[model samples]
Target: MNKHFLWFFLLFCLGAAAKSLKCITCHLHTQPDRCRRGFGVCIAQKHESCMILQIFQDKALQLTYMVCQQFCRDLTFDFNNRTYVHKCCDYSYCNYDM
Candidate 1:
């Protein structure tokens, strides 16, 4: 009985550890050395991914942002001659490079 209890405890701890999701977050006019906005742990009830978004105008990067998302869909659209790109991932700090 004691051995079973210990095994259950260990598994419970492991399960808890596996559920945490960390992601980098930032908003910048241009690429920066680090996430100047901040880093955050994902806690949204249905959101299990991180996202990085960029918008460009005249081939120059105009805006960028990172956030936790429910789903990461690769999407592109244009408005006012600016192009927007979005990338999403499901690992800790996956948006760090964006």
Candidate 2:
């Protein structure tokens, strides 16, 4: 009983350590420095606009082709795979939701 308990405890600790390392690796590549979320970009926008702008940054020009090819999945008018599908701009006198 003691041996099995020790083995299980060690395995749990190792699994936790591996998860932390995985988070660090993915965050280092996909996120910027000075992160609060510690793994994603910090974009400030109106709550409505965040989804639209995020898509542009992720997909780029391919946003125009919305046929959902093998490369692009989860297509939507405003969001794609948790990213926004268009650019957001601050233009005076115009409140477009793009």
The number of the candidate with the highest lDDT is 1
Residue-wise C-alpha lDDT for candidate 2, range 14-94, written one tens digit per residue:
886553311110121222323233233222223221222123444543222111111222334644344444333322211
Cα RMSD (Å) between model 1 and the true structure? 3.2
> What is the alpha-carbon lDDT for the whole of candidate 2?
0.31
Question: RMSD in angstroms, all models?
Answer: 3.2, 15.3
Cα error, residue 22 of model 1, in Å, equals 1.4
TM-score of each: 0.68, 0.23
Runs of candidate 1 with Cα error greater than 4 angstroms are 1-11, 32-47
Task: Name model 2 segments beyond 4 Å from true.
Answer: 1-4, 16-53, 57-73, 78-83, 86-98
Model 1 residue 30 CA deviation (Å) reads 3.1
| Each candidate structure's count of clashing pairs | 0, 3
TM-score of 2: 0.23
lDDT of 1 by residue, 17-63 (tens): 77777776665535435455554545434655888889888978777
